[model samples]
Target: MTTPETFADLQIHPAVLQAVTDVGYETPSPIQAATIPALMAGSDVVGLAQTGTGKTAAFAIPILSRIDTDNRQTQALVLAPTRELALQVAEAFSRYGAHLKVNVLPIYGGSSYVPQLAGLKRGAQVVVGTPGRVIDHLDKGSLDLSHLDYLVLDEADEMLQMGFAEDVERILADTPEYKQVALFSATMPPAIKKITAKYLHDPVEVTVKSKTQTAENITQRYFQVSYPRKMDALTRLLEVEEGDAMIVFVRTKQATEEVAEKLRARGFAAAAINGDIPQAVRERTISQLKDGTIDILVATDVAARGLDVERISHVVNFDIPHDPESYVHRIGRTGRAGRSGTALLFVTPRERHLLASIERVTRQKLVEGQLPSVEDVNAQRVEKFRDSITDALNAPGFDTFRQLVESYERDNDVPMADIAAALAVLSRDGAEFLMTEPPPEKKRERPDRPERERPARKVRDDLATYRIAVGKRHKVLPGAIVGAIANEGGLHRSDFGHIDIKVDHSLVELPARLPKEAWKKLENTRIQGILIDLKLERGGRSKSDKFDKGDKSERSGKFKPSGGKPFRPKQ
Candidate 1:
């Protein structure tokens, strides 16, 4: 058997091949290119590849190619380490063979078992199940693998780590001897290699080149925001961005639909692509996106693969991806064909370390992106309104509309500007108007500060500074910041001033010499999903830079400034 370079080069069934063509898979992986030919010819295979390298498809292609659609009994079995991975693999099977009309089911714990038993009784051509759930089905006689011709051990190392190795071994023992065994693992640890030596017979070996993740062309960016203000931030982003198309990625399918619904409710052309969509409907939604009928697509990582719409110039990770490779793939949906694209990741306070891990993996700094100013959003909205009016006036029947407006104005004793203002107010969809004045182009007259001027202090050097990890995106009001310090940080409202919140961080001024007990209490508390981060102030930097590494409050050296006592809040 020879290696396959493309999906067509493999001996996949005509139906599955058609499905692949529909799903946009052109090239196969190095492992897939190497192992497909042998597996299609009924030889066992042992493939070693790192995570997020498309290892699922290397074996899936061959097994689906070999399954007998007419028999309907299970002909292929895939064992996964976790329920999430199991469902993800099962979805891949369905998406690749939906046009072929094959039934694929994923069995796992923490989900209803009756549906799985019923699905197996209905004759599944392929079954992907986690260990405990699979064994449960096996004992109940609801699942039969006697006729199985192919078996897949995916992420075997993870399964063993999760204490599923014994169950997997038992499953392998129960599977028919003539079955083709395809084992894939990221590492060849002794236990895994021993299982490989025992279960697979002189298997063809294939290892895909694990490319350097550090070289991924992802321009990672994060906006520090609180949970409550996330929707507002996202809406503001949608209002100002000029992407050709965008996909907002979330962690869950429900999140995909929820975010999509919110965007649609705001009148954007958006849709959700998830596991729950019917195959035909999903194809329709994708076709619309590819052709520009849709502008924003909300999808999970697994549901978004092969979504190679070249017009997609933006990828918004509504939540940070679980792993760096996933970040690569999610953003990889954009930035294709040598075009520059933008990827914005939303990082919660707890998820900052995850962002750091991604940076360490990819070796890139995700520059911080500012949440669009209310002025920016208002400008965009006004421009859009102008464009809409322009479109209407440019139409053939606008002369009639003009005449009607003139007549109404004459009869109603209204000035044209008044009518226009009314229309503008009517056009707004109950959103609050931004009334703050933009700064003048040139500097206005102001008193010059001394070159040696000290930073502003609250109440004659009674000021102390506390860093909070929250910012504008959390919908945290200035009053909330003030109150948190007053009630929680044990400072009076008059003792705080010059509050500022950048996208990922916030800062407030507090009395320098807080009561000893109050300072001690403030040191350990968090506020509004952010660490209170109360500490003495020394320097000034960008709001983002100030808390970039978090606050520097320590236990021993920590004290009130100017020989004052440590402040502590009461119980």
Candidate 2:
């Protein structure tokens, strides 16, 4: 198949083409080049591409081009997995269809439904929503799909994984029989294949394979450290690395703000971009990053998509992503436009398996490296200090300041050298001139040591165990539990301890002195649609007295837990 050189080459409507140009899209991506024509030809399409491949516009442009502005009935419906993604898609459609005068409405949970009802009443031409809420509207008969001419499923695999397959099927069943359907997924699993076979008719398949060869100009490295030491290590690296701009990728929205605030407190020009920030402010933050006002940006994966800045010279993975594809996408923000960039991955000891998985997928071994030493940080600081003085001397308006300083020196009968020394001290303020000493390393068993002779692990005196109401019965996994708590409580994954899952309850260890606010939030948090009802476990007895006394053996490493599971620390 021949590739289209630009959006215009695809023969899109002039109005939509002008909108695309206004949005600064010069050329179509591979997916856009392949899928746009098929979609515009009134054929069902199956798009296979990864994130950040410009898939939104591939479908949006065609839908906008084909919409009948005179007919206000809903002509197209797009379903996404998350509210953030749904809003993002809606924004894209609005941007690309601005000149076409098409009305696009985004309906999702957590927002008032009044606006959605009003939009439907006004006869919106396009609707974008999540599957569950879409089903809710369909059940209420408030949403009309009889006139819907096109249905597009964005992130089909993610929707299915979020347990929305049945909802998707039911929603599809409500639409007209002749309505065109399009499915876009990052990976085509068996479930997705089944859906395609059932819903689509001779769909035009377009697969855009990701570039397997990792960016040759990008240097990749990894550092092994515990969770408590991550902030210090990151600060040291920031001091030494020579980058015009850097992006730090964390796992949660809360972490983004916390990390950015901490960095700013430590004297770095940093800000955060997350879902909570208003769209206008997010754009302003990006503008600041581009213009060199903000040197560091801490962001989550969802908020950082489509972020293209030529000044981004480094990408730091503050927390490892859950999947290899996400890791690739996070690092892909750098090393763009044929420029060299640096990618740093922070891995705990227990997360080595994830590190290996990333290497296996990327087909490149990352170089193991140590954090910058205190001496290195001090040296860099001294260099920066000298450069600042040199710049001040070369500045055009320094004569007035120099005369003032000289006058002060003369009035106080102070020598010029002493005056300079005093001024330098004032400039330094109370900030530390050197980095703190590195934390002591934890000891581990040697490969040659006999199993019986190895030392027993030391018990943590600072941690306290708590019992939660939901467990194996609710189909909760260790990762899910950890993720929920860490994300909601603003704690790191490594902050968790042993997680013992029982038939109806689970025991999780966490820091004993949690903040009152975090404790309250944990009490109200839910897992798998079940309320946590978290309570402190005192002397092997829960506050509710639900746990069996005999389970003490299981908790103390005597009798093995279910499935012969040994006690393993949380990653």
Candidate 3:
């Protein structure tokens, strides 16, 4: 039989084909073209394809076509290596089968199991989950594969590499022999080969070779910053870096919202999108990005799959990806169709190894990025302030304000320049026109000296010390503290000063007078699964020492957005 060229030509259900058409996909990718037909024939199939090769749809479309949605007994099971991928696959299934009203459930670690248990009880036709979570459900007798019609092991190589081989086998052993299995992997290692040999019965093989190289038209660079200071670094880059529109890639769904909120607080038009967001909202946000309503999008890896925006001039890896494939996938979001794009990576000291792995995999060395100096940022601010002035001069309805200023100048016998300077200060909205404090100099590395012997970080006077109830005993790290504070308090690195970890607790330096809401959130924030119980240090002088004890309606301080027009995508 001749192979099908279009998705409609395949044996896909009309609903699935219609959904594909709605997504503007008329042609199937190589992997999709090959694997979908084989799976539709009720044959076990093994697919070899790299990341971003339409592998998810390759299996999802066929699986959805064959789903007995009316049965609603967990007919299909897809095993993924990570929570993000599981959510991605679940979302794809949901989208593809929307017309058929197929129920898809995604379960993973680091999330509450109550929802999963409830979902399983409510009944879903398709269940996509991580190996560990799948095994957990199997142990609890919540997942039954006895009547499963389709079994799929997506990213099988990554699952094995992440030490889930035994869990994969355990799940495989529990499934009925009649289940049609589909295993997809980027490479054929012994571990993956063994799983296919023992499990898949007369499986047809499909291999889709990658048609393009990694980041050919992309310029890549990395900035080495401490964990707590990543936000500070990111802020400086946003101020000085030249880009039309940007997509910041973070690791978690919560981080997407957190980072986007922080960016908005700093006067950037930003939005967050993730698997947790409703599909309608996600689509609307993407549409806004395309129409230049918002210039920056904060997203997780899975949430950004299949995203194609021609105006995205920059891609920022706010959190370095876990694998090289993810790094390639992220950078590929920009620099499309022979266009040049820039990819920036933020690397902490501990994540240098991951950076090295990515460099080796991509066969390209990432140039070290130079953080914009204080003077550079000040110059950018000055230019923005100048533009604001020029805009006021050209805009109507400013005649009254101009006359008022003129009268004040004449009445006080003040020079026009001095009057203008005073007015500028008042018009700044509490943001500094010039940065006074320079960033701390990076410490020199000494291969000859041990880490314990390095000099202690200097504390700045602007920062007030607070104590948190986590330390070495709790196995706390600086990154954990930074992530907890940034994610929970919505505070950035500029709001932090220094950290001194002790045995039972740790001392962290923060803004002397924080907003009441932030203080309350920080007090209850947990690090390493323990409440931080953050408190102001005794004898410390500040505008308010009564943490969370003051009037709830009042706030002591807030970070101010800089004066400028919100960023817009270039036409």
Which candidate number maximizes TM-score?
2
Candidate 3: segments with Cα more than 4 A from true spot: 1-3, 110-115, 212-219, 224-229, 275-293, 335-340, 348-369, 437-439, 442-571
Candidate order (lDDT): 2, 3, 1
lDDT digits (tens) for residues 352-417 of candidate 2:
999999898789999998887878877765665565577668789799989998899889998988
- Model 2 vs. true fold: TM: 0.75
RMSD of 3: 9.0
Question: What is every candidate's alpha-carbon RMSD to the true fold?
Answer: 17.4, 11.4, 9.0
Per-residue lDDT for 193 in model 2? 98
Candidates in order, TM-scores: namely 0.66, 0.75, 0.73
Q: Model 3: per-residue lDDT, tens digit, 438-483?
A: 3575665745767679675554444688888999998877756665
Per-residue lDDT over 1-571 for candidate 1, one digit per residue giving the tens place of the 0 to 100 score: 5556678878788887888888777998777688778898889888888676777777887777777788889999999876667878998898777767689999875456678988998999999987766777888889988998889999887677555566788899888887799998877889898888888998988887565353245465789875435656677776666667788887655567767766665556788997557879989999998886777889977678667887787889887865677787788787787777779988876568889988887778889889988788767555555565766667898889679879989999899988877765654544334323333334236577898997544222324455677788776667556544543333333456577777766877654444565666555444454765665555732122111111111101111111122221111
* Model 1, runs deviating above 4 Å: 1-27, 37-44, 64-73, 82-84, 87-105, 109-125, 161-163, 176-179, 188-194, 201-205, 212-220, 291-293, 435-571
Candidate 3, residue 472: Cα displacement in angstroms equals 22
Which scores greater on TM-score, model 2 or model 3? 2
